[model samples]
Target: MSRRLFSCFGKASSNPNHDDKATTTADLTTEEQRRCGPVVVELFSSQGCATSSEAELLFSRLGRGDFKLDVPLILLAYHVDYWDYMGWKDPFGSSQWTVRQKAYVEALNLDTMFTPQIVVQGRAQCMGNETEEILSCVASAPRVPAPTFQATFQKPTPESLQVSFTGALRTKVDQEGVSVMVALYECGLVTNCPNGVNKDKVLANDYVVRRLEKICSVKDISAKKTLSGTVNFPLWESFNPAKCGIAVFVENSSRQIFGSQNFQLPDNI
Candidate 1:
């Protein structure tokens, strides 16, 4: 059976109760600071999918700098390749992302995978286009242990970019496993679809993931081991440094994200 996409619309706003100052102020305790960690939202979508355009717009608005949210919001749009053969091909679609979505389906134990599906903090799923449902999930999301995460990017050569990250779990947990994942995303991406269900429509996408790379994995949580790695950037010919950034996150065996951070690329790079 073909999967159906859900839709809804409303004015965008941030969580008011979130304490952004907790992260920067010395007055707050460690627990208070961890409460300020950003919520990670992953949207599995495709340009060729009939209902994905609306979800793309919703996510774009949420990722905007001027949205004025109290808590940090980290959004990633992963385009899947499964729909490309249906007349119009999605330029950003990737088979790797398709596999990623499938992995989520298995983790969530869902019978089927569909476009315009939003996964919050890698722990909850909702209809991508429904602002209320998405926000509700974000608000009720369980607070996971925060980890110290840092990332840096530089253009080593005209044809290549280099990225490095360092992280250490800050709190104790009894997880069976953990893995660090890094994603490269670009904003202000525009595409004009001449065919398919969205024929003749222009779509704007934000935080659209260009590549996702795994950094490392951990088996023992009791030990405080620092995780670090340097990787060559997955260069996209159409990438604009002004609209690109990186997100680093740590996920456990059950696919629950414990911590995450987002960094925008330097303008000159």
Candidate 2:
């Protein structure tokens, strides 16, 4: 089995159950990017897993320096709960995330599931927290050739905010089964690890996945074309209003990332 999602860019298979599905995102105007902020790094992690703990620590330390550069990289940590059965339950784990991870495993044929996985630009994946490996991955990572996409949060009503994106598809990059996914997240989360494998450790999680809207394709991602769209964020009853934010990424059938960005829900949003 190939550990790849789509051999082509944004051209997912029509078969929904065939492990590859094509997607079309809603349309938007071209002016949205200027209002949206920086590039985001989404980390799939877990506290019950010791490996993720180290990755989280190392990433946190890196944020202090690597992010000081002009390109400004944002780090978001999502805690996967599948490992909760191993003597300690990760209070932050969501069944939805477990399902998401399983889908990636099935699509990519990972053979086994593991924590501390990092998806960069929805184009590649690597074991997280490994300084040497991560450095190499970044140094050799391909440039995101697609048109730039940007998003911002707008307060629509008291209970919901609108997430809008702007960009163009200069050309179809993925010949395989790559698609884009938009998500909402919460930032600056701290948990007390009283009983998990990370017991006695205080963990700070960033970019925690909150709501996933849909899989998308660049509207007109051709060389000089441009497009945009919006996703409404309904208030979830269980979510912490204070910690909620948003994350967006372009991913392939294998769950590798192509491009991604995230933002915090405005104080008023």
lDDT of 1: 0.74
lDDT of 2 by residue, 1-269 (tens): 22232111121111112212221211212343332233445567887777677787767765666434333454656677766765678766887776676676576545455677764433345677666665544433333333366666676776776777777533365446446667777656688888767778888776666677763553324445555777887766666657775556666555655455555566755
Best by lDDT: 1
Give the lowest summed-lDDT range of ten residues in model 2.
6-15
After TM-score superposition, the amount by which residue 17's alpha carbon in candidate 1 deviates from its true location, in angstroms, is 24
Q: Which residues of candidate 2, in runs, are more than 4 Å off?
A: 1-41, 66-74, 106-109, 122-124, 150-152, 171-178, 218-221, 236-245, 262-267
Estimate TM-scores for all models. Answer: 0.83, 0.68
C-alpha lDDT (0 to 100) for residue 112 of candidate 1: 67
Q: List the residue pairs that clash in candidate 1.
A: none
Best by TM-score: 1
